[model samples]
Every structure is written in structure tokens, then in C-alpha cells.
Target chain A: MFLIIVEKSNEVIYIKITKIAKAGTLESNDILIMVMPNDSGNIELELESIVMQQFGDVIEQVILHKVKEMGIEGITIKAQDKGALDYTIGARVETAIKRAI
Target chain B: MQKLRRTMLFMPGNNPGMLQDAAILGADAIILDLEDAVSLTEKDSARILVRDAIKYIDYSQVEVVVRVNPLDTEFGPQDVDVIARVKPDTLLVPKADVEEIKLVDIMLAKIEEEEGYLVGSIKIIALIETALGLETVYEVIKASQRMVGVLLGGEDLTADLGITRTKEGEEIFYARNKVATVCRALRVDAIDTPFTDTNDYEGLTKDTARAKSLGLTGKSAINPRQIEIIHAVFAPTEVELKQALRVLAAMEEAEKEGKGVFSLDGKMIDAPVINRARTTVELGQRLGLIER
Candidate 1:
């Protein structure tokens, strides 16, 4: 039964999960990212940051860039930022997505 | 190419504050740690952070060493990939043995070729943390032409020996001595492990003194507070510096007289003595203890 399911190419294409996968810490200069599967093929990002007023768009772009780099789509990311750098944000999202998959 | 490695301070790779200020901490080398310092889930982030840190930070004269994950782990290859591109001064390989050191050397060569980096420019610091690593220390040190130093990992080595860790460092005495001996024999730097008790200034001083007594070139520092003590312990004292200068003067006079051996303060100054005096003078100059 498992082999038949794996053999069907279309059956494995949409294997997405609704479970929330989290990565990173709430420590200063760190960000926590939670990722979950979404069916609409749209990336919904909810960012809460201390520097949201100034760096919001840049942070969003970084997260999106990382997600695209991983070729991920149809996922919702909840990024709780505590003034994290671009590298930290990307790492958290990458780890969250890996855990989700 | 022996460099000043008196104090190699380790900072967690993910901590931006630490990374930003690493250069100003006055350590001889700044080690951005991507292994034990980072949690499992944060490994990717730490690597990325370290990669960017290496690119942007002005380490000035302080050498930058990145402690990458063990080659057997999932993050190791990724860590090396970034490290190769970033090109830190050295890579510290934890739990390193002969084969692992050789493997990383090969991997680094390949990465250097691919990235157009100078082959063997990035050096290797084999962190001997396992019993097997300890047993194969000679082979591990000899495995790579890029090998610049060997660091003893006390905590893991103690665990491997099933012995208790202590502040006095009695448990790691044998391992430290062995590493120092091997390093001296192979003409590479021997770096002692960090003193875990960050707040015990007296103990830290004593531990560093013990390392110096064992003829270790340097010791790792977990905190900035320890850097001064390590440096002080390793620096040539004024009396020693004076003696070294006198020896040099005596040797120069002997050379003028076409003599191979001479005496200073009623003691024979032969090759070994002259060599020691030269090392003392060089170290004093390097540490800014002696006017160049």
C-alpha cells in the first residue's frame, strides 16, 4: 500500500501538513518562526518585531527570499522578531520549514 | 607560519551582539562557534550568521576561527560550504581524528578550487575531544599540511574517559601534557581547552599558569574576562625579556668572535638556550612587551 502510494506521482505532490513547526529562541537579537501548511499556495506572513516600524519591509523581504530559496510555497509563517538580523530570520524560517516538511 | 594564538575566544555564532563586538575583545583569535554553542534547531541560523559575520566584520589583526560542526553531522557540509566562501583564517574541527582531519583537508581543497580561493590558505585546528582522537593525536596532527594547531577538548575528553571534571584540571593533566608534547614534536601550536568556571578568576589564573607550564602555546577562552589572564600568563615577563636580550647580545658578540657557543651569567648558552632566548624575544615583541 505504501509503495503504491509512493509510485503514484500525483499523490505525493500535495503532501502538506497543518502542524506548526517552530524554530529559534525568544532571546534578544533572535527571532522565532512558526511555519504551517496552507492550501491556497499563498505565503501569509505575520511579523511582530521591536523594529517593525523601521525594518518591517526589509524583514519581510528577507523571510520571503529564504522561503523562495528553499522553494517553499503555500505556507504561513509567524515570525516573532526581537531585532534579529537577516541571517537569523532566514535560519529560523529555514529550520521551521524543514521541521514542517 | 606561527601566529600569535595566546587566547582564542569562543562566541556563540547566533549572537549578533557578540559577533559584532568580537574583534574589539582583544583576543588573539576570535572563534565563532557553530557547534555546541548553537542549539540543534538553530544550527542553520548560526552558520548563516557566522558566514555574514566573517564577511562584514573587521577582525583587524585578530585571527578569525570558525568552529564548524563535525563532518559526520548534517550541518558539517553546509558549514564548510559557507566557511570556504567566507574564508576565515582557520576552521576548528571538533572530535577530530586522523581520517577526519584528512577528509576536511580534502574538502577544503575542493572548496578552495571551486571558490577560487588560494589552496591551503585556510588552516585547520584539530579539536581533539574523543578518546580515539587522543590516541591518534600524532596521526591527526600529521594528516594535513594545513594543520596549524591542535586544541584539547577537556569536557568531552573527560566524559570519554568517564572521569569527573574539575576546576583544578587534575583530570585533564595527562591529556594536556600529551597534546603539548605532540604539538611541540610536530612543531605546531598546542591550544589548551577553556576554563569552564568563568567567574573563578583565581582558578582561571592557576589553570592558565598550568597550561603555560606544560609548554602549551595558548588556551581557549569562553569569556572576555579570561583573555587578560591568558595573555598575562603567556606574556614574557620583564626579567625573562631582559635575559633574552642579554643572550642575544652575547650571541652577537660570539658571532663577531667566530664562536659557535658562548656563556651568559656563567651558564653555557648553546643552540637550545639561544633558541629559547630567541623565542622569548619574539614572543615579547609580538605581545608588545618589548620595544621593537
Candidate 2:
């Protein structure tokens, strides 16, 4: 969000997600994120946003970056964005991850 | 010198649109509310959201305030803990009292030391809303070294008093006087509560003017439209500014002539008048109503 991006390292830390966690809302300028455990050893993200055409890639990157920052892997993230900035995106992801763990 | 805080606008903490636009609004300070403005279920998410907004957003040239829940509530501790890490300009403690303020101050001190932030870098503003807090308001303001302001929560204070809050505001008159006088004595900002009716600009101006006359430094605005009206009421009038300038000029002349008292337009001017004029000039300069 601050233009400081870390390399997505190969070392992936996996934690057992015992329950589904969700954060944020569909309000304008907000992004709702839901996290669940996935059996596949890969990170999957399902994204839908009002501004998908303009900022979908950046929003996905922010979510992945935050997930990567938390060293989370083998998890599925679903984000519903309504033009949320990178900070909001990052925060929503962090909150969802915190709840999931 | 005291800062100009004539209009402290209240913005919902969880709304990213409002948070992003807060700085561009003309209020002297913007209060990001995590208390009554937020729902119980959304507390966790709102705290994280507000922290990130403060961390990433550029709120330049305007003071940033965050109103956390009361410590007795479950969310209050986490709110303070998470929000303090971002180091907002000030924390408005609602349902405030001496004991609560002391606890908040202690918590802030520990965080400041642990995080290597300057001890007392984060200021505190007490929201005195209950009868007991009003009775012991002086002690509350003195409880913390970080105390910089006190806001009168009229809605809650009137509810505690078992009285209806009318547009006339006669019910909170005593509370207003007490809070303002104590804040003045302690050299802190005395902020009046928001005038909830957003449609009536005339009523808003009158309410702000009354609060200003009662010695309040500022008034809280529920709507952005109330900001300029509150600021206008607080700014010194053209006649008042002209008279202040004349009194100041005469005071300077008196000082050169080795006298403590002077006269302007056949009227006696003394220490109190001189001090008042100086305060007006300083306030005028702060409001950008006159050239420094």
C-alpha cells in the first residue's frame, strides 16, 4: 500500500484453518474479505469488484501481498471490493486472516 | 499558544470515503469515531480499518482524533491498543472520569515506552458526559499529562440528567459553563457537542455562537455544512477586530511612554482590555482573518 512490496518468497508457511473468517462490508469504499481453508497447496483468490476493469489487478496484488506478508499459504481468499484503497484492502485481508487463524 | 479548534468535525471511523476526504474538509480537526458511530459486531473490523487509514492516509494540515469506546466495554482495550500503535493526534475518551483518564494515561505510557514513541506524544481529550464526570471534571482533566482538550457530550449528559435536550439548549447551560470554565482554568480546549440537526443552518449558527459566548473554544459538527458556520461564529467580528487593533496600538504607545494604562477614543484601556485585545489579534491571525 505504501509502495513497499516484498518478494513473494518460495517458503510458504501453512497453518490449519479451523474455521471460516470474514471481515469488511459491501459499503462504498470498502472491501469484504472471506478466508477459508483449502486442500490444494496453492493460494487461490476469487475477486469481484465494482471497479474490476480499472483496479482489479492492483486490488488482487494487495490482497496477495498481505496474505504473503502473513506467510499464509494453501488458503482461499474471496474479496468483494467497492473501490477500497490499498490500505483498506490490506486491513481487510489482515483482519480476515487474524480471524481465520 | 492554543491551537485553533473552532470546528471539530465528526466522521464515521469505518467509512473509507469519509476518512479519505476528512483532511480536505475545512474543519480544524476531524474526529474518527469508533464509539457510538460503530456497531457492536463491526468493532473488530472498524478498529483495524481506522488504524490502517491513519497509517496510510495523508491527513495533512488537520489534526486527527479517534474516539475510542469506554474501557469497561470489551472493545475499548483493543481499540486503544490497535489505534495507539498508529499514534493518532489525540484520543477522545468518552464517558470520561478521573479514574478512566488515569488508566488511559498509564496504558499510553507503556505503549509509548515499548514502541519507542515519545512519552506523552499521543494527547487525550476527555468527553465529560455524565453528572459524576461533570462534578469531578477538574480532577479528570488533571488526571493525565496528555490532556489537551475536553468535549461536552450534551446528548448523554442530558440523558443522565433526565432532561430532554431541546434546540434552545437551556438544559445543558450549567454543564456547558462548568466544562468551559474548567477547561479554561486548565488551559485546554473546551469543545461543545455537535448540533445534531443538519438541516437548520440558522439554528446551528446560533447554537455555536451561544457556546462561544460561554467560553467554548470550538463546537463539534455532525455535518460538514456546519463547519463554516461554527468557524464564522468563533472568528472575531470586523468591528471587534478593528477595536482590538486600536486598543493594541494604544497599548504599544502606552508601553513606550512608560505607562500601564492608556485611552483610545476617550475611553480608558487597562491590563484586562489589553490582554483581551492581544488574544483577539492572536485568534484573528490563527483564523487567517488578518495578516500577521
Model 2 stretches with alpha carbons more than 4 Å out: A1-12
Question: Which candidate comes out best when scored by lDDT?
Answer: 2
How do the residues B139-213 of candidate 2 rate in per-residue lDDT, one tens digit apiece?
999999999999999999999999999998999999999999999999999999899999999999899999999
lDDT of 1 by residue, B15-128 (tens): 877887899988999999999999987787788778877777688778999999999999998899887788899999999998888889999999999989899999999999
- Candidate 1 vs. truth: CA RMSD? 6.3
lDDT of 1: 0.86
Write down the lDDT of every candidate, Cα atoms only: 0.86, 0.89
| Strongest candidate by DockQ | 2
